[model samples]
Target: MTEIPLEHVHVAPDEESGGEPAPAVFVLHGRGADEEDLLPVAAELPDELHVVSLRAPDPLQGGYTWYELDLSAGGLESSQPDADDFRRSLDLIGESVERAVDAYGLDADRLGLLGFSQGAITSLSLLLEDPDRYAWVVALHGYLAESHADLDPDGIEGKPVFVGAGAGDRVIPESRTTAAVERFETLDADVASGSFPGGHGIGPQELDAVVEFVASRTA
Candidate 1:
């Protein structure tokens, strides 16, 4: 695999190479956080799985944003203006994953996605938009985008998905999370959901559940 600069995207191989193509997990960070934020979590996973952490394309005032936010509304305003950009970013990441699979000789059927906050939302969107691409998806403290409701159920056929949310999360409401879970179930995805007593972040319990879910699918 070609080595790319760790600017807006970072891709790395596992240290313990066994001369076999390694399964991969792509980590996406929340707004304001960079690719490095999720590197430690990569280390926590099986070293046999190559990990890649990607940064958002748009730069925020202080940190970074995947796409622009529109707060001028009755609810969250996700108009076409911002939606197009978000889709482009997802496409780029998807292409990157495909490249990694071919270059590393990794099994495309074993690809996984792990994302937190904004990244989690993107991850969910990617899987929903192009369901055949991933084996499993792990979403932490993120809600499905409004556009996701229109996705065809036939796209995701029994794909494994794990969603972890904080009951008291202010950014992503519990109600929204529940709705996302229902949406995934409606699409025939094998969904596992867990909620904890916290706000807007993950805990050890959620992490454990996510790891177990991935392990089960990859096993």
Candidate 2:
């Protein structure tokens, strides 16, 4: 595996695994957020999961972002990703995950993904690009990139996918998220969805659902 190209941190498993490799969840934070932004929540997951949080490659206003957003003609709801930057990140992140699987003593068969906002968009894209790569996926407050809609979903059958967003979320728009859910369903993935009040962030109920979805697989 290649060296990890992005900065990252890890939360070790809660309990000792008797030296056996542990299942791991690779975490990605939203745009303008660092690796530490989701550390607290990633820790909330069951100790069985070894969590690795990665910082986005690009530096933004006091934070990091996975890719650049082109909002010149549209607002957040219609904003598009810089295709070149977005494509680059997809490859970068995928390579980092390969390195992580070996470096972190991660169980290759049970790898998972968790992402928020822009991070969520990237996570979903990675899963689509390689359907069998992850055991499950959790995406919050983000929408699918239109660029990835044409990918073949051949190996994604019965995949566990949880997508959540606030009904009032103006940042990504609930409609966009719902569209992602529908797309997953069309691919025959076992998708779980949640809608909460307010906008553009994870709510308490939403977080609990994410935890449960991951725990079931790890436990």
Candidate 3:
């Protein structure tokens, strides 16, 4: 697992990490977006949580992407990230998680994931690969990748997951969202799903749900 370079931000409670470890959440932004893109959302989340926003490693049209989508497969079926590249990114993220734990004295059991759009897809990918590595996940306007279907469903059983999709999202069709939710449910994940009346973006209502979801997990 080679470590790929990643720019990121970490925010934790003002108090020193002398006592119990704090809860932490890794925030991932959408495709063509930078690490700072999700800072506002992180700010709105619970202050007690140690938030870390990561920048995707791959550069795109003046922005960044987790991996390149393989259009040849049709309908965003796969991302054409070389095995090494993908593994490096995943390793980088894991390194980031370890760094957060050491920095904030975070409880490994309370680590969570929050991602939007392409980030959301990556979050699911990470979670599926190592469910215990993450305590909970909030995926907004994202769908599961085909690779996820090959994973062992029992790995994620009983884990908490919040999947929020926009009903009017043209970017990700309802069918995709439906498939994502159904996949998690089939794996026996403790799924909490909602649909907002908007497009491929999060709104006030969805934010409220996100806040509540994190609060519940971090509480």
TM-score of each: 0.87, 0.96, 0.89
lDDT of 1 at 15: 60
Candidate 1 TM-score to native: 0.87
Model 3 agreement with the true structure over 19-55: per-residue lDDT tens digits: 8887888999988998889888888887778888899
The most accurate candidate by TM-score is 2
* lDDT agreement with native, every candidate: 0.76, 0.89, 0.81
- lDDT (Cα, tens digit) per residue for candidate 1, span 1-219: 654322434455556556767678888888777788777766667656777777777777666667765555445422222577777778777777777676666767778899988888889999987787787899888888876776875559688898888988887777777878988888888899999888877767776777777777766
The alpha-carbon deviation from the true structure for residue 172 of candidate 3, after best TM-score superposition, in angstroms, is 1.7
Which residue pairs overlap in candidate 2's backbone? none
Q: Per-residue lDDT for 1-219 in model 2, tens only?
A: 436788899788989989898899999999888999988878889988888899899999999988898887678788878899999999988988899988888889889999999999999999999978999999998888889876767789899999998899988899999999999999899999999888887778888888898888778
Candidate 3, backbone clash total:
0
- Those runs of model 3 whose alpha carbons end farther than 4 Å from true positions after fitting are 1-5, 14-18, 75-85, 153-155
Q: Cα deviation of 94 in candidate 1 (Å)?
A: 1.5
Model 1 off-target regions past 4 Å? Answer: 1-17, 75-81, 153-155
Candidate 1 at 212: error in angstroms? 1.4
lDDT of 1 at 53: 76
Model number with the top lDDT: 2
